[model samples]
Target chain A: MTTNKSLFLIPKFITTPSQNGVGRYVCQLQRVVLKFCKNHGSSRGIREFIEYDLLNFANKNPEVVVYLKPRRHRGPVIKAEYLNGDDQIVFCHNNTREEIAKWLNLLRTQSGNHDGTRLRKLWHTDYPSIQGPWTPYTFRDPALNLAEFPNEELSRPLDQPKTATEELDELFKKQQESEVAESSEVK
Target chain B: MSVLKRVQQWATFARIWHVYDATWQNPFQSAELLKKYLMGIHKPIYHPMNDCGDHVIVINSLDIALPGNEWAKRVYFHHTGYPGGATWTLAWELHRKDPTMILKKAVYNSMDGNLQRRYTMERLHIFPDGNVPPELMGNVSNQIRQIRPMPKRLDHYTKEEVEKFPKIIDYPKDYILR
Candidate 1:
């Protein structure tokens, strides 16, 4: 039970086999029902679609069972059933023949009724990383495996500048070289 | 999951053991450094709710340095939950009682006051000196660098090195001995 209201009410899912089209394509729509009145102004476009395009649609997809229900004084409706035990309904009342055909094609291509559900991710991957997941020893130096703990060299902070003692030593060496050169010239 | 993926999951969440040398380092600064390792903040997969913290073994805690006058000014307070039971101990006095107490308190106080603070502190192992047990020392795979360099004492250097060092001035024969 999630505290989020939207997440709790609506189901969330990743793209699974029910929505995949990778290797082989399988039509998920199992059946479709077009219900329209026999003699009504609203059913005019649906009747026209049934007379002109219904045969071609049925012939193209033999897997889907298309049914026609002629009712009296009823608005037109398109109902789609999927193999995943989910169904979708679209009201085609007063819709044009072209619009009805487009709706039927959309319902036929979808894997299932994904409305009222949230998509967890936009993309999916079988292998998340090319190299591998990161580990503690992934970028670590191999020398640490053989070295002893509390090592002075490893414990010291890096990039320290010269100290006063070192500076004084350098100055003393330069002065001594100058004195040696003076003595050599005199000799 | 396959065996390889299971092993990869374990590798990503593995609790690493790190060693830190506290010699000649300030306790407060070292505490800030050690807190990150103890809480697993140094890892790439760190999450506030996840248990990904690593173990830290801190050695040479007895040699920890405190800033000027901190040993005298800093105090630890305690109450016995009774009337007239309040007590305050100076930092130096507390350190004298327990060599590891200063650094331990430092790391403890550096973390947030959450339910996981006590559990996170449990992973920190502080020793008074470098005499750590062989079993614990064997698990350490990484070392935390000290914040400050360890200054070399004059007596620590060899007699020859000291004598060969450049002299700034020569003392007069009539100079009075201090």
Candidate 2:
């Protein structure tokens, strides 16, 4: 089969924004810069978000510094600077107040690190195993070490898949054997 | 268990080093344990779909223990995708062929069949013995406790130490000499 061509394979990790920290989390978003126009039709949603939701968001996340810049005739844009020295710019031309809020929330929650195209792993940790990792010799029966391979007993499957009817028949046979043994003991 | 503690846990993520010693431990249990790390089940942020697991370094693959007659009974099946190209290798034979294959297969089989399984397996570092490469040494942060204690070899003990070890009984003078 032919493999498809791809632009990237591995994901990229950022500097400061991390989800797997050592029992501590540092707020990654350092500051947010919002640029909007005073009388532009496209800037209406951003203006509404600023007027209504911005104050609450700022109050809730006191760690994040929020700045509002009003330009003469520019379209609205939101620029977020992360602690990792990366800046994410979201164009907000003709977006709604709810959409702006959603975008702002996304930026706030992000660790500022982007996994480029292919992620090597989803999770990363320092302490991987608590008990231990398994290996081939972990639970090996000592008999196998000394015995030769392809031996009669070991060469067969460890367990044969038994059906319910077979199990009942075995039980009946065991009961008959026990009863016969008791009768012989009485004699 | 408190709400405040829960909130703090939700906010903070800790990366810990885990080491798994494969000496004399069952391969099945080892696979189960590694699956936890591969699937990120050991972490608080573990979601079935999320990659939030830690790295696992397994040592002593050559000395790993297997239960029952699995050495000969267990078979690892493979296909070449060609006509009459199926192959079945016995567990012991596979181990002798490649010491790490048994453990790798066990851990691999334990994982859910998905694209993410490949990503999870990447975090697992396996070694046949104590000799770890320099590059992988940096990735290891902490060691997980051994499931089974390392069996002490007779050569490892000093003469005095072996003599000092308590004896079950002493031969009586009256007892018949061989």
Candidate 3:
């Protein structure tokens, strides 16, 4: 059961992986430092990804700096540094070469922020209302300002249609008026 | 909310809204207003490529007004690509066929022709009437008031109320009103 979970979390723009630093997104991972044991079983995958795919990946994304550090009798760990001064550390043990490469790619694409924070708004804007922000006076007619309130004509609906009976009465009155004018002309 | 707080939020985080009422409102003017919210043009963070727009929910679109003689004069045209497959529909006829299409077409045509236009339009949710689904209500953080006031319905008026209303002229005793 999701008990009041919606109120606790904030929504955000998951650091849009800056498309070549277009101003909206900034590359989260500036540098990645990989630490692994030279002779350990867990170090095998890290060693393989670095040997096979590391060079090509580095050539493709020259922006991210990669460093490989070898230690003795320790587990393998990946440290990712972001442009926002935030650090993400991941532990990789008993993982295959493919999985290690996948993790490296994930780190490269991320903006270095964890999920589940509160989002103040669903949308954001830089240039609000090109026409203008609406106020009480935005679309108000200038004539309304000069007119008095509770005026009968203004209060009534403008496009109200005439009732069938009223229409018939008006038609009959028009016929009578025409008949009277014709009688006078004949006289 | 205070003006200062609203200005601060405009500079930072402004949420989306669902504004429905279009009763007695000019469709052209209404389209202009819709375009502002759709493109996120109403916020300080608006960008051409950046998707920094807010979601807009429109309901009661059937009652949107077309000022002057636009209902008779304004026309919507479309083609099926086949020979003599073209069709031109008047504004009133289109509204009679589908109430939502007029507003939708108006908003669609008002947007800039760009690759991101379809994505921007996705943020706009329009409904024919007042029945908004349960799922979409969660995203609506505010309600924007309609530009024109909704006219009073006939059913809301009572016989006593009508009798009490002031009259401009009093007819003679011999005169008969049918």
* Candidates by lDDT, descending order: 1, 2, 3
Candidate 2, superposed: residue stretches over 4 Å from native: A1-187, B1-16, B172-178
DockQ of candidates 1 onward, in order? 0.58, 0.02, 0.03
Give me the candidate number with maximum lDDT: 1
User: Whose DockQ is greatest here?
Assistant: 1
Model 1 scores what on Cα lDDT?
0.91
DockQ of 1: 0.58
lDDT of 3 by residue, B32-107 (tens): 8878887878765576766657778777788788888899999899999999999999999999999988988888
Please give the ranking of all candidate structures by DockQ, highest first, separated by commas.
Answer: 1, 3, 2
| TM-scores for chain A over all candidates | 0.66, 0.63, 0.63
| Model 2 chain B: ten consecutive residues of lowest lDDT | B8-17
Q: TM-score of model 3, chain A?
A: 0.63
Ranking by TM-score: 1, 2, 3
Q: Where is the poorest 10-residue window by lDDT in model 3 chain B?
A: B11-20
Share of reference contacts kept by candidate 3:
0.00
**lDDT values, one for every candidate:** 0.91, 0.75, 0.74
True contacts kept of each: 0.85, 0.00, 0.00
